[model samples]
Target: MKTSLKRFFAGVAAAAMAVGGLALGATSAQAAGPVASTQTGSLTVKAANGTTGHTLKAYLVAAYNSDYQAASDGSLNFDTFKYVVTKDNGTKSNDESAVKAALTDAGVKASASGSASSAAEEGLRQLTGQSAGTPFGYTDGTATASAAERKFADALAKKLTATDSTKWTPSNVQDLTPGDGKFTADLNPEGLYLVVDTYAQKDGSKSTQSVPMLVGTKFANAAITTQPAGVGEVDMKNVTVPVHKEVVTDNTGKAANNTPSYNIGDTVYFHLSTTIPDYSGYAADPTLSDPTGKTIRQLNLDDEFEAGKFTGTKVVSVKDATTAIGDQQGVLENGKDYDVTGEDTDTVTVDLKRLVNGADGAKTGWKTGDVIDVIVSGVLSADATTTDKANTDAADKTGADSNGNSNKVTLNYSNNPKDNSQQNKVPGDTVNVYSFNLNVHKVNQDNNPLGGAEFKIVDKADEATPLQFTVSGSTYTHAKKDTDGAIETLKSGADGSIAVKGLKAGTYVVTETKAPAGFFQGALPSYTVTIAEHYTNDKTNTTRTSTKSGDDWLDTLTYSNTPDNYGLVTKDATSPSTWTVKNVKSITQLPKTGAAGIAFFSVIGVAVVALAALFAVRARKASRLA
Candidate 1:
């Protein structure tokens, strides 16, 4: 699709109207009357892709002149291919002066002094690249419309839709249904018709709609040479607006992750994205005072998160990327360009229709294919649960039973170009923020529960500093450093279990700072717990250019104790694996007062008596000499 308004509808209209010999054959001759009822042909708008569930409506823009001659080789030859003003099947009006003037204004050529039929033929010839006094390319059946032909077709379709749209009524509607994987409309008066599709939104709707196309049924029976081919049939190209949800890791909005992990009490950045739909045939509504003919009724992005796991949802920014040539972005204003309802709640809805249609005095000139991004921030709750296994399906919303905290985004946009009131809902892939928990158990050599053990946890990256936590009796909750009411020690309960929750993906060291009263305090048991989640991007290109990529989050757990040899100390088979720490008794208590003590006292008394006698004799000898 072209980014500019002038070339926006060029390819779409050209592809739709450029039959490439895909028109129907007229079996009957033209009737001699103002309206040729015999020239009617059965036209089928076959969805080559076999897509169902769309309403195809055709409006007769003009009536073809009855001047074609059937050739011998099953083809119609015409020196002049022209469409004249006739009563529209919709409004029953024949005032085609406005239509001709619109064609002329769009650079289509028509005769000023010729008959109305001749002037209409000349304009159509210029639009279809068919020249007067030349046979239409039906004999060889290898003719294709050129780029110039397509450009003019787009202009003609747009003008007719904008200037004379009221001419279409209920009589020209066709409910395209399942008929051998194709839809064939009933035989009607053959002429130049504008085809537009509409889909009704329902529960679990896969509403795929078709772009506006122009089909000429007057030249029927030309077999289609495209991939989807049939007699008098044109392929209906359907489009589905896509929506994506990702984790924004940086400010550039280019770095995104589908598989992400975060710690509890940490703020997670979320990004919701989708491109603008093609709005070629949509006309301005006079009721809304809309000047741009590309106004849509609604374009919304509703983001839903696990309410129990996420809190304080904040919309950071909403940007319209690549507003124009050389312009990188156009930041939309809150409550104006887009209104965010249910902000700070579990579900945040961003309404982008105002910016899409330039409603309420907002700036216009935003083109199709523009990327709309809604960036939001939310804090992971301290009560978030750890996932035992990674979620393989990104579309699954069962976060509580399957994986981690899930953030999902759903896009709702106008499905019907003619009627903007109807909308289709498309849910994007869900991205998750994961965290893990570590369970520690204190026990004796017998593997019995031993209580009163205090422990602390520190990240391996910075083992010098212990992670802070808020202690409540025996329970410990993860907290930030210097946080109010944060403590350094987490005491074990009577069950000898200490649960440390909301841990990020990294190696952590859990050491027992205070052992039980009588347990050996020498070399308190310490275990290293590593929680890592690895992701592999399936993209072949290492440079990371496109957004269409996939990855899988491989969650892993590793644990090891400080001492190489420990009695009955092991990890249990459980999610958030439990490490049972064992303690031994101190060898200090022995007999205090017994028979051994009495014997020791007797020996000491005898040695003291001998020493005293020797001292007395030495003192008497010294006195005599003096």
Candidate 2:
């Protein structure tokens, strides 16, 4: 029996060893398989403004371990985890009730289990694959408990060191330092997780995990400035006017001095000084008169020196007489009424009709110290009046001056018949009068009048369109030139044309009366049309030039004349009525020659071809031998 029992025991022992070996092999195989993916779990703790640094560290470690387990398994469920937090200096802390309270306020539930170890164990049991009976023995070896705890501790240390002493404390919980404490844990799971160990001191000092508690994924930062919706409107009243140059002269005699001439619809500005004490009140009045008795139409204060006060400066527009008042008058006397003598003659004339027809007509004749209205306009014409001769003979006749001295015939008039006596006439004042001198003479190269020539003023170049001239109280007319370049009559139309009258042959210039409106008159040309002696009788042959042969006979002559269609000239003397012909030569009768170096180059090219052939033969022989 003893032997049988021994054998039985040995067999049992052998079987047990076999079973243990099988289990060991299976465990080894499981460990060699792919590691399971991990998830992230977060634990956030908040404490009062002033909490002990050691206490904050302890809380962070405990919270990290709890979340890591809860995320690993499903059974363990603990909000807060207890720990014995220690600083690098070995300073240790017990239960951190302030940290626990802060965590509770931050949405963390304190564990009723109470003990740090128990809370940690229970939290671990809350996650999957993590229980007291699990493969990891409820310690969450697969989770990041140890790493997370270390991270949380380091963050807590940084937080406590960076706290500001004043505005923050454990109780008041104000002035919390940003990122003072932080915690982060990397898990081997599909999701992310984080554990934040944060604390505040009673004195506003704070300590948190060094790294921010991260869970799941990260989000992008927010934008700063945004684009505007629409553009702003511009106000013209607030805009400034651009400055421009203007010409201000004494009289219309220098009208050409108006550099920038005014157009019909141009807006012009004027500067005027007033003797009036308070010119500010006149700004609102369109018709403000100056001290010189000149009226300003559309008068306005350019700008105020000291608000609502005028510095005697005014602006006015240039337009027709009725539009701008006081523009036609001269300056007025200080503290006095309008004065006709002091008024601007130009502006007064424009406003004359208005003054004469209105109540002011009785005071038409101006003097000093009278309140008179003046209109300002830029339409002052330099050539306001002009004169023309009624008869050429009368116009050509020389006249004697008042002193009986012989002078050239000229036209003269009293500029202002109303003031014929020239009572207030001044050199600078504008004058209205007829032409002073006929100034009829030939135009020279310098545009000056030439002597000893009577300009044959014609209406048209066609001889049939002869011009009529009044001479010595009689009218003289000329006719057009015939095919022979001679006129038919000197009194009336003949040979289907008009008579050609006699005139002094010389250069003459034709000019128009007044330049069309809106156009400036250009300077006249120097040279004018020449009326030769021949043109008086034969208008068509006016510009003809004759060349005589040995016998003084007109053999072959050439004529160059304007208005070319009037007549023709014969080239032969025997038949002076018709033209002759002549023969010309061909162009190919000229010379030709060969290039010098080109022939030599051609010969060299032939020699180069021969040499190339010899070399090719030698090269072929050498190849065959090789």
Candidate 3:
């Protein structure tokens, strides 16, 4: 009878292996004998290197009575067989009455005649066929779980976790550590088991979670089966979706730069991107609007800017740049596939639920490995904070920590496919935009301060267009021009200082348009000022370095003035590069009328007599020679 039982399950085990599951088979060479009740085996699980730090639990779902057989084509098969449920107290209670009651509780009918109905046996077969590779009926050919598979899995979970929780207690549990890489469950009776990752949370880190796996404790022969003999080993698989953000060079978002500069009121383009991982194991909800629903899974992108520093926030487009088909369909549609909350505000969020599952039963063009891009733009408003350093680009020495506007973006994704309510957040790198100021001072050759000098500044890149500024007394602040009209000239203050604020990093030409009253206009060369930020690996001359929270980048600030003769002046010994323009007083004392005029005429008459004597001498010398 035991030999017949083993032969009956050979076909069933083969079916399971056909769809990526390992089949349970006898390890002993005595394959033709009646199976012993003391038969036992071991199961081993191997996962990716970095994914091993977690807790794994195994629960016995059914007890198989026989080994699996492999065909000549290397396919597994199990014969028709009967499986018994173990006692809830983690022991083998083979009593017929108790077995019948447990089977009844699991919606399976058991007969005293030792034969189950066809319907009941089919239901049990589905449970035993669960595979480690295709959890939730998600196979390589299927994009998601079918309706029948979802119903069966959900029903099984509810039954296993009912008031009788002990009925499904884990048979073995292991807490794996980093670099361990594998887990083993030994001394298990011949049975099919379900293994689950209890600590599958990938929060703010690179490690991703694994889905539930099914393993058979009883192993097959090495020659007959492809899997490892005596140890049913399965490789745990996972998929991760990492995100990246940057201030790009243009609206196309092809170029990436973490540190960029912009003039006040200039449009700054931002690019946010991430790849879509496999969502076949994830469950979909009936109510798309309810994120907290029992079955809804979520993946969102949250972005924030420095308060009041940006305006006209616009989500230019969100598309899947991986394939041309995805680009044509816009993978995720606004108001249908995702909802943009907090638009035009400092904080904006893109909620992506319907993008994975279809919206209104419509399929999405998105698929695994699709590269998603979110393009956004905003104007660098005048509300941005400005700084003046004791020295140019010395933000670390005596000024605010950052003299630039900044924004950050992060990805909130469904890390665990089994648990829809759980999420893990991974932050992208922070991006910065820098602007600078140019200071001018009017002085005399004696270095005395002279007020009421006027000047205009223009960017060397676009000389035809003069920069507009709003003046408060003698201070100049950059203002966006509505029309291409002439801009106002800025004058020096009583302290011989004029500051032009809110300019982007570039070379600028400063020209003096008017001189101080009653002073001869000094020949002032076109002063060249350059403002820029540079990155380096060296420790010396670095303005910003790594932080305790994992921000590690080296950079320095550079502000310089050409024609180092007058040199840059630091106001109050520290702040703003001030260029000093020197002037001289005009001559006013005229020559006296009588004395000066008579002296001038007497000198001319002396010069005329000397010329006549020279000419007569030359003529007499020529006649003698002739």
lDDT of each candidate versus the true structure: 0.58, 0.22, 0.56
| Model 1 residue 183 lDDT score | 62
| Cα displacement (Å) at residue 218, model 3 | 8.9
Off by over 4 Å in 2: 1-424, 428-458, 461-465, 471-626
RMSD of each: 10.1, 42.7, 10.2
Off by over 4 Å in 1: 1-52, 57-67, 70-76, 80-175, 178-196, 203-213, 218-239, 281-296, 324-329, 359-364, 388-401, 471-474, 534-568, 573-576, 587-626
Q: Residues 520-587, candidate 2, lDDT per residue (tens digit)?
A: 22221122234321100111111112411001101111211232111111133432111211111111
lDDT of 1 at 451: 92
Question: TM-score of every model?
Answer: 0.68, 0.15, 0.68
After the best TM-score superposition of candidate 3, give how far the Cα of residue 367 lies from its true spot, in angstroms: 1.6
Question: By summed lDDT, which 10 consecutive residues of candidate 2 come out lowest?
Answer: 231-240
Error of 3 at 9 (Å): 17
Query: Cα deviation of 342 in candidate 1 (Å)?
Result: 2.9
Residue 150 displacement (Å), model 3: 9.4
* Highest lDDT model number: 1
Candidate numbers sorted by lDDT from highest down: 1, 3, 2
